[model samples]
Target: MAKVTLTNMCMIYDKENNKVLVQDRIKSWKGISFPGGHVEDGESLIDSTIREVKEETGLTVSNLESCGVIYWFNNETGEKYFVFQYRTEEFSGELLHKTDEGSNFWVDLEELSNLHFAEGMDERLSMFLEKEYSEGFGSWNQHQPGKLQFQ
Candidate 1:
């Protein structure tokens, strides 16, 4: 079977800052990452994101939109897979410093570059936070050995 991985549609909505939330990944985490994780077997991507947020930040999302995905190499494990992106224009919940994954926080959009991040994260997250962003989702066929195509 072809090795396929499911990317969780993760996001952070902070009405307090009027900016998307981001966290400085700690412990075993690769780097600062948005709040999310992989989709469990038989679980839907949308459900995965919402569940992850609850388990990570105690937030509740009423709606989330799939924005995009990124195919890239991971330096640590040398693992490469597509990462699904999602954003919520509406949500409700309180933030707390709790998660088995990493310490969570709200990173200002303008100051996103201040923190270190995993490869390809900045490019993808920036798009998710964009107002005019549309398209950039679905399967990415290998056009070349090291190339990725998104639809």
Candidate 2:
């Protein structure tokens, strides 16, 4: 019997270029990711992104819109987790590299697929940056067939 964890994420857009910014994680993980992280026990999704981004990049997140939900399960421990994805086209403050999450930088649309990324990275990305303005939330879930329901 395991448990699930919830994380919040934010895709911050460049103020001048209007392109979304992504960075490489320093301490661990695959390649590059957005400027957000896990939500705290008492924190809201919006608050979590704002705080996480600031802590990771020192940029104040403003005008964030919820994009989607992501669900995953640990292969080893059977732990499930969910993530809330957000989009912010506007922001203030300077970017600061705070922790081992790596050096923060912005990437253009053409450069997104070129970056070394974790598995399933391109899936959500293509949707987020998709043209035609089809804006909304999404759900990506990985449920184990034999595993008992957590509920």
Candidate 3:
């Protein structure tokens, strides 16, 4: 049987400074991405997104705008995963000293695409910034490790 998993990611932006909080992921996957995590069994997607953001960045986010769901498929084995994407500029809390997930820091919007990111993150970030609060939906498939085919 093929396995499926649900995950969440949020792009917390500082509209005034044109920056966004990103995590430098070093485990399970490498490269920079937004702060987020797996959606536990029975957890609502919005709740999961809020919880993950707080746990990773110590910021309680609100006014979340759903960017859409990314359906990831392993074309060879038929395994799949779904990632719920979100963006929020409204949050309150002091940034934490550290998080187990990785190093968290603010990156300027203009420079985000230049950073080394996990797979398709750069594209996603660009889409969010370009739309300027518009909703986005997309999908991709992988036939081999480290090779992503987006449609």
Give the lDDT of residue 139 in candidate 3: 36
Best lDDT among the predictions, by candidate number: 3
Clashing pairs in 2: 26-101, 26-102
Tell me the TM-score of model 2. 0.77
**How many clashing residue pairs are found in candidate 3?**
0
Query: Cα lDDT for residue 20, model 1?
Result: 66
User: What are the per-model C-alpha RMSD values against the true structure?
Assistant: 5.1, 5.6, 3.1
Per TM-score, the best of the predicted structures is 3
Better of 2 and 3 by lDDT: 3
* Model 1 Cα lDDT, one tens digit per residue, 18-103: 67676566654467778777788999878888887777778787678777666555444445565667887577778867566677
For candidate 3, write residues 57-134 as lDDT tens digits: 899999888876667676666667877888899988998756777888898888888889987776666445655433
lDDT of 2 by residue, 1-151 (tens): 7886878768887757757678677665557778677889888888988888889888888888876666666666767777777888878887775467888888776677888875555556744555223322232334433221211
Over all chains combined, what TM-score does candidate 1 have? Answer: 0.72
lDDT of 3: 0.79
Q: Rate the local accuracy (lDDT) of all candidates.
A: 0.66, 0.70, 0.79
- Candidate 1 lDDT score at position 90: 71
Worst 10 residues of 2 by lDDT: 131-140
TM-score per candidate, in order?
A: 0.72, 0.77, 0.84
